[model samples]
Structure formats: structure tokens, C-alpha cells
Target: MQRVMAMRLRLLQRPVRIVAQSNAAFSTKAPEFSDIVYGQDTGVRTVQFNRPEKLNALTLPMAMHLTQRLHKIEANKTVNAVVFSGNGGKAFCAGGDIRALADNGKDPATRHGEDYVADVPKSQALKGQGLGTYLALTGERLKGHEVIGLGLATHYLPTSEYETLVHYLTGLEFADHVPQEQRDEMIHEALEELETDEAFQEIDPEYLETVESVFGALNDNDTMEGIFERLEKLNTEWSQETLATLKKMSPLSLKVTLEQMRQGAVKTCAECFQMEYRMATRMMENPDFFEGVRSVVVDKDRNPKWSKRDITKVTAKEVEAFFKPLDKDQELILYPSATAVTEKEE
Candidate 1:
């Protein structure tokens, strides 16, 4: 166990941020629909999931709205950052509204204008929605400089969304090149979209290089097999705990912490510190955040007692309150120096 644990520790110690630098600008309001609110100022646009009646859970209109917004932001040079948050303080977003989705499926009115609505039978409406059902798919191609997803929605949302879009993009690429009738039979069809997309293809080389560099630094044998062994060891519970700690320890003061991380491989020490502090200040006051933590941790009641139990009841003042900094942050550590010696070396 110790040997296994030690290998895992060595492999997992390197800091790894899951998604790379494709940041999508968040649109606060659902432009196409009145119910959703969009916030755009400076370079950042926040698309607040406003339907509190449904825990800000998404609907088909919301998804279409998001897709259009992302496309608009990507086309605009002025906007560079975006965030996804919920209107009510309770959630960033509650995945998808299964009940609303089921209801929407039955209603032909809302389904009329959707992208895949024509291809799939009315009965299989929801299932035919494809990978775009999640948020990341709509935003992946636009590939903004920064994107931040607040609350529960941040989990696997971006990753799965990107993968799905990439897959379709690859498919479209193959479909474009081959005879229409023969396209489906391509042996490498699964990730063809991902493989061929200019944006996705661009991200892969960088990510592969990053992974290879990290693995090379950790593995003593420096062999292909050794790298796989290291990956295996580091995927255990201990590694996950270490990753969680790293996420918690991240410089929280920045306004767009997740966005900054996604943009590039490196940051100056000063830039990192400044952003961390800014983010921490922004996060200090979100009542929903506290409610969520309490529900999940302190109360153990499993149901969050929220500040604005209803999103419509939520006010701009309350959201503004979270942005107010309590005090000048104390002396803080700057970014990690690339030249700093690794613990493995020590």
C-alpha cells in the first residue's frame, strides 16, 4: 500500500487544471427568451440561469439562447470573458430540469424551432437532443479567452460539453469531405468531429504536450509503460483528495479564476496573486454559496436554506453585495516560480 501510495503521491503532486485555455464568455440574459437574464459589462458576460421556480434548471429555449449568445460573443472582439450563474442564490445551475424537459418534450410549441427537432420523432424529442444538451457544446467552438461556471453546474459540464461538440464537429468534417451516403461508414467515425475541428484540434496538441511533460517529470523509468503506470496510480482516492485540495488552495481572489487558468500555460507570479485576491473578494459574499455549503456540510439536512429561496425574489443589490471586498487582503503569496525546485528534487 505504501509503495502504491507513494507512487500515486509522486504522480499526482503536479498541479493540473482540468480544462485548458478555451474560455467562453457567459451571457447573463437569455436574449431570445425574456425569462433569462444576461449580464455583460467590460469583457465579461454572465448568463444567469433565472428560472428559480426550477432551480435555474435549463429549458430548450434557454439552451438555444445560450448557443446564440456564445456565437455572438465569439464573433465580437469587445467581449472576452463569460460566466454562467443561477438567478436564485441556490445553484449555479441544477444540471437540467428533467421535469421541465419532459414537459417541454410533450409540448410541440416550444419544440418547433430547435436544431434537431426535425430529425428525431416527437416521442424521442429529448433523447435526440445530442451532446448539446449540456452547456459546453454551444460554447466550445467560440472558444473565448475565459469562462467561469458558478455553483453545481461546473462539475463535469464543461468537459462533457466540449467532448460532445468536438465529436460532432469531427463528424461534420468527415461528412463534408466524403460522399454523403458513405460518410457514416468511416472507420474512425466516433471522434471524427473532435479530431477535425480547427479549435479542438488546436487544443489537443497543447494538452497532449502538457500531459506528456508532466508524466515525464514524474516517472523514473521514463518509458511509455511507466507513464501509463503513473497515470493508473494517480487516479486513486488519494490522488483525487490531492486534486481537491489543490482546487481549494487555488488563489481565490481573482474575479475570473477559472477563466485565467483556461487561457494559457503560464502566468506571472504577480498576475496570479492579483487575480486570486480579486476572485476571493468576489466570492466572499454570495449567500447561495453559503447556503450550498451549509446544506452539503454544516446542517447535514441535505436541503439548503437559501437567502432568496426564489430567484425572482433575488435582487441586484444582493448580487452586488458579493462583489464588495471586505478588506484589503493581507500579505499573500504570489504565483509559483517556474524556477522553483520541485519537491521531488528536494
Candidate 2:
């Protein structure tokens, strides 16, 4: 893990120049994406996850397709910003498809192996490391307000004003080199439309309180060991509920998730993706992950019989193994441009 982190730091030391290009020569037609809607009007490009029946549960192929589309968007100078939403008005995304992970009937080798797990989480972590760990481990769905409160989303809108927001975005026109304040003003006006809705206002406090309480508890400890220890000692109703929830999850996953979140704080987004690729590959070999998917997704039984029921029994050595690199061919390969710029550099 230290060697990988050192390698990442060395990679960042090298300088690369990015020359801005004009979009006039590029194609205007939106590229087709599987399980996604891609469209552009004026300067705004919108990407909508389109699997309503499954609550927009992202599959491996869907994630890869979306990633490819986003790369294309990055190179297109016509797009000012992107508006991401989900079809069916229920959820933006329900995270990965656990049922697909558990299903080994058609292609057993491809479905349940080091390769399968590495591929899925590698794509997800490239987008955001913290959210990937939380979603992959707990399978907890986030609604509009929760998503916004977590800083994963910039704006929140009620379902009623969804079309209005899209229309407003599509109507917007910007100069080739627009002022930041002008963009902010346009966004402020679009957000103002949702402020008038009583339902949207009502959800705000509840989600904010939820985020505060959970994060406050998490902040009480500096390390994952200390955090879990504090959690075990707490007597409050929320603490008890949280502990019960943790008990239900796979022990291996919980340990891996904690390490993922811990490393995410220090690692670049691209580095975190590489780390997740290694951790997830090892997780697939463990029986608990398959059992977790079987109980929650396949059978809908809500009872997963984990290999190690008690968190304390999950050895530190066991957790450490997940961080080791995979074979050269199996490792995640990140694009140089995907490396994030640190706040200090800005």
C-alpha cells in the first residue's frame, strides 16, 4: 500500500500541459449509451440513467458506457456543464447490481471471480471513492436531499420541477469564455424554481439532520478501530440502530469499506480507484460477498450468513491483504488526465 501511494505521488510530480480546443469541428449529435440517455441543447448536456424498473441499478457495462460518454464530454468544448438525473423519478441510481454479481448460471467464471469484482468497483471508485465504498458495502440508496447534502450533487429539485430545470438548462447560452459569476447566477435562478415547492423545503431539514448525526459520530474517532470501538460503547438509540445495521453487513466488506474510506481522504481520486480495484478483486474470492448478494438481492431474505459474524474476529492481517496489488493484466489502468488537481494547486 505504501509503495503504491509513493508511485502515485511520483506520477503527480511530472507536469503535463493541456491545450484547450474549440468544439466547432466536433460532432453535435449525442453518442448512444447503453442504459443511459444522452442529449445536448445549447451549452448544456444532460445524462439520465434509464433503468427505471430496477431503480436505475447500475450494471458493469452501464458504468463503463457512462464513463466513456463522460470522457467524450470532457473533450467537447460546447458543453458548459452537465445535468445528471434518473428516469422514472424514483432514484438517481441504486448503486451496483448485486443480483448480477451473484448470478453465476450463465457464465460462472465471469460472474464470480477476482476479475468481476475488480471491474465494477474500479469504474465506480473512479467517479468518487467515498460514495463507492458506502454504496458497495451497505447498498443504501440516497434520495435527492441526501445526495445534495453529501456534496455528491450540487443542486436538488423536486420531481414536479424536473422538466422545468431541464428546460431552463437547455435554454441557457454562454460565451466561449464566460464569467464564473454569470454561470453562478444562472444556476441560482434554476435553484430558485425549486425553493417555491413546499415538499422540497420539507425534505431539507430531515436529510441535513441525518447527515449531521452520522458524520458527527464518525468524527468522534480518528481511526477505524477507534470508531468501531466508540460505536460499541455508545448507548443512544441511533448508535444502537447503527451497530445493529453494521452487524447485518458482511464483516469482510465492513473492514474493507473502512480502509477504503480512510485511504480516500489521503489518495487522489485516480489512486483511490486503483486501490478499490485491488480490494474488490480480493473480496470476490471471499464467501461473504456472494452470500451478501444472495440474501439482499437474489432471495430478498434480508439475512446474510457471513463467514465471520463478529467484526472483532476479522483479523487486521485479513484486512491488510485486500490492499495488495493484483497481477499486471488484472490491475486498474487510469488515464493520466483523470488525476485530480489538489486544492493547494488551485
Candidate 3:
């Protein structure tokens, strides 16, 4: 525990800058970091991550620094907006370079040992689009026509028109002379004009069939082991690759993700975020997230010795515990303010 706290302190020390709302309103001083730069416009603050050689891979300190800068921005009333950018031309981010462990740890629910999960799908379904929610929660990425078909994207403009769209948005940003509704119309029209018929093309029947057979089966899986066994029976290249991917992930994370996806399908967007916050808190307490980061990203070993190596060893009770309600005071309250729950539900 001392080691964890020491490592955390080491990571919190870094160089970062923020456009102060005012000099008098802040008490915290900027840390000494060379990899980040901050700039300001009339009412905009620009934060540029400056690790071009490392593809702007965010160190733990950088994350802590960015959090501080964000807090300062939040306290200031004068700052109109903030923009994040990367200094490199190659990649925007290479992900975080994390250490072995960062936070708390816990054992399984009731069993006191991580129980190998074997559970059944709930017979009842939600009022919302559960499959869509499940696909997102399980992180089943959709590309090209798949994205449009899954309602994941509203606009599918061509590569050629990207620059044009950016320019139009930038010009409109400075053109406050335009009314808000007119501005909205102009943006919508610009995207529509740049769109291609490629987006409207019918999804392949074979693709739908595969999705039904694969993802559909996954949805009905009782446990991670069941999912793997189901995949192994398919004995195809895609199934093999999929198993490899899942194995690379933290076992505990997989369990949490499974439970969250099932819950989020019927949940409000705010409710989903709240549920995720609980899951994230529990994951931090699980150590597997940090271990996953160390083995997969920082160490490059690609071998994470999870606390529980086997999915069948994971319990349905254990998975559900991660989503249990936190103490009342710690709960996320999205409906407290006027703009609360403002974003559209996915």
C-alpha cells in the first residue's frame, strides 16, 4: 500500500499549463512538465500535448496535470471553451504508460474467492434497444456500413470533404453574425452536401447472418467460459482472433463489461454513466485494470497473470457486485441541474 501511494505521488508531479480564469481565483501552482504546452485565444484555452517522439503517449503525471488544469478551467467563469490537441503529426495519442497497480483491490462476492461464473440470461428485456446497448458496452466496433446500420453514426462523409467540413465549421465559429438555428442548418446542409451514396448502401445479408450467429450467441452466453467454448465450436479464423482479443483483456474487466452491457441496454444514458462509475470504482479496487495496463501497454510483455485466469472461475455474483449501488453520497446525480442529462441517450 505504501508502494502504491508512493508511485501515485510520483505520477502526479509534472509540467502543465492552464488559461487561468483569473490570477486571484487559483491557489495551485503549475507543475514542472516539458511535454505539455498551454495557449489561449480571446475566450478559448488550447491544451497541446507535446510528446511527438512518443506519439503523445500520456504519462500518469500528464493525466494528473490535465485533470488539475481542467479543474482550474471549471472554477473560472470567464473561459468560454477549451480545445485539446496533440503536437505530433503521426498519432494523437498512444495511450497511457501505466505501472503495475494504481489503486484498491478486492475478492469475489460472497464466495470470498473469485467464483467461476455459470449463470443464465434474464428472461425479461428492457424497453430500450438492448442489442445496440450490448454491442456498445461489449465494445464491438462497427466500421463503414456497419456503423451506419447500427445507428452508431448519423453522418458518413467522404475523406475528401473532411477538410472542407472543418473549414466550414471554423468559418461559422467566427461568424457569430449568423443566427444559431441558421448556423445549425448550415452545418447540417454542409454535411449532407458532402455525403456520398456509399453510406446509404444496404448492409450485406451475410454480414447480418454472421452478426446474428456470433454476437447473438455471445449475448445469450452464461459466462466468459461459455462464450469462449461457443466461439471454439465455430472453429473459424474470426472466432480464433476474437478469443485472442478477449484473453488479452483483463478477466475482471471482461466480467464487469458483460454485466454493464446487460444493464446499460435498458438504462438511461445518465444511469449508464452512473453504473459505469460504480464499475470503474470496483475495477480500480480489483487491480486487474492496472495489471492489464502494465502487461499489455507499459511492459509490452502481453502476458497478464490475472488474479483469476479462468473465466469459468469467475462468478455471476462477483460480476453483479461491481454494479451494486454505492453509498448514497457517492452516487452520480445527473438530474440535479437544468442541463443535467443534456446529452442524447445513445
Candidate 4:
């Protein structure tokens, strides 16, 4: 009994090492990292957005840092899984840094006439055509349950369970280090466990029904004007609230967003990205976006006096102008050959 107790004490005194030497393969430092915090324990690497005050809103530098880290992790044979999180408990990420964007447009060096257009619609279209448009236009946030129902998130855990879930997931042994045939069997077992998790099984049906209605409204072949007309007829309180919310958004933005979604329906993912690039370039020239950001993000005033007050006032020609391609130098180059760079020797 004395020998066993001494052995147990020695084990307890030793440092807790979850990862083997093979797993500590990547360099921990990044050349420029301010907006995010990165850490690795065992096989789980965590990339957490660090700006709590701003809800971890994305900036170009922050995005580049994340991309670089992901590439490094991919190359490391040690890492089994990654966890993306926010430093602040309030939000994982609130999306892009609209304030920085507004500032860039104000800077003489960066300001092109087209830099005045809002790019929210472009982002939303990629997420889920019409739904993305609606959320972007209205700046409506989704609750945890709503997010799960929309399939944006695979599982929803209450705040109480967040820490526990993190502990459990990080403790899981990666099948990668195991033999290939056993790896498949291990994955099957993990998936089977996930199938029985209460959070996965308990999606809110009411939220899903609401999502379906909103999607149907946004995807209808009619123009933004016609879609609103139908939405106005629905007698439900939710419909009334949605219309009221829509009324407060920039008229030009709503129309442009609706058009973008309609066009996105038939386009492939790559094609949609191309269309978005065109819209983004054109939006920089529009003044409504500047005013919208000034009111909402800069000034903290909810009221924005848009360039166009009513949706009916926004002409088809004005909407079509956003789709026109920029000059070759200004157009977005989507090819990997143009953007790819070899990693520097450490």
C-alpha cells in the first residue's frame, strides 16, 4: 500500500501532458496577431477572437492572421481538431468591422467613388441567398435556438454546459494517430454518440417554420416591392414585426439585396462570389452605405436618412448599375495562381 501511494503521488506531481511530443509540431508564434488569441492543448487547438468590446468583428488583418494559422495547423500532423471561439462570452463574432470599413472610405487614399456602396448584401447571399439578404438588411441577430434551427450551428448547448462541452471535446483522442481502418471505426462511434445527444435532437419546430416562411418570402420570383406587398398581408404578429423592421432599413439596400438574392439562386457558389465582388465594388460608390454605417455603427444613432426613402423610388437601372464589372485592375482576381505565395523559411 505504501509503494502504491508513493507511485500515485509521483504521478500527481508530474505535469499534466495531454499531447505527445509528435502533437507539439507547429510553432506557436504568429508574425502579427492582435485581434485573436491562439492556444493548443493535446490534440485540440483553439483560435479565439480576442476583441470583446467590439464583439470580435472581423478586420482584414485579423482575417489574414486566421487564414495563416489555419494553414499552419493543416500542415501540422499533430492537431486532430480545432475550436473556434470568442474571448468575450457575449458573442463568437459579430461579423465584419463596419466601422473600419467606413473609416477606409473616408480616407482619401482608399476612397474611390464606388467605395460608398454597402457590401452586407454580398456577404449574406453567400450564407443562404434570401435569408442572408434579410438579416443583413435588417441587422437582425439570431438567438442560439434559432441558429441551430437554421442549420448554421450543428449543436446548441446552454451556457452552463459550454465549459463542460469544451473539456469533453478536448479530452477526446484523435483517430488520426491510430491505424487507418480503426480510424473509420472510431469516427463511426463518435458520430453514433452525437446522434443521441439531446441538443442535436431538440430543434425548435416553431423557429424552423418561421425560417421556412422567411425563406419563401425572400425567394419568391417577384421584385422586392411585390414581395413586401405579400408579406404585408400576413396577419401574424411575427409578420408585422418583420415588416416594421424592414421599413427601418435603407430602401436602396433592401432593393439591391433582394436583387442579389434573386440572381444568386441559379448561380454556382463560385459564380455567386464573382457576382458579390461586382456588387461590392459598385457599392463603394453609393452614398447610402456610408450614411447607414454612420448612423448605426459610428454615431450610435438608430435612424438613418437613406438616399432613397421608399423602395418604389429605387429604379431598375440603379439596381443594374451594381452588377457592372470594374476595370481589370480594380476587379477581384479569384484565381489561386494570382494570390498563392510560398511560405517563408523559418
Q: Highest lDDT, which number?
A: 4
Candidate 3, superposed: residue stretches over 4 Å from native: 1-87, 90-140, 157-161, 173-179, 196-203, 217-222, 333-346
Question: For model 4, what is the alpha-carbon lDDT of residue 45?
Answer: 78
Model 1 lDDT per residue over 5-107, tens place:
4433432342211122132422233355665777654434556677887677676667766755676676554443455657666656665554543334345
- Top candidate when judged by TM-score against the true structure: 4
Angstrom error at residue 184, model 4: 7.9
Alpha-carbon RMSD to native, per candidate: 25.6, 12.5, 13.8, 7.0
- Over 1-346, each residue of candidate 2 has an lDDT whose tens digit, in order, gives 3433443344334331112223452223544565888766666777888899889988877876676667777666666668888888777777777677656423546633332533433323423233444454455666666555556556665666666565545655566566766666655645654443332433456534443344332456533455455556765675566667766777777777776666665677667778876776677677887887778777889888889867778898898899988778778776576563322200
lDDT of each prediction vs. the true structure?
0.38, 0.61, 0.55, 0.64
Model 3 lDDT-worst window of ten: 111-120
lDDT ranking of the models: 4, 2, 3, 1
lDDT of 2: 0.61
Runs off by more than 4 Å, candidate 4: 1-32, 111-137, 173-221, 337-346
* lDDT at position 196, candidate 3: 72
Report lDDT (Cα) of residue 99, candidate 1. Answer: 51
State TM-scores per candidate: 0.26, 0.68, 0.61, 0.76
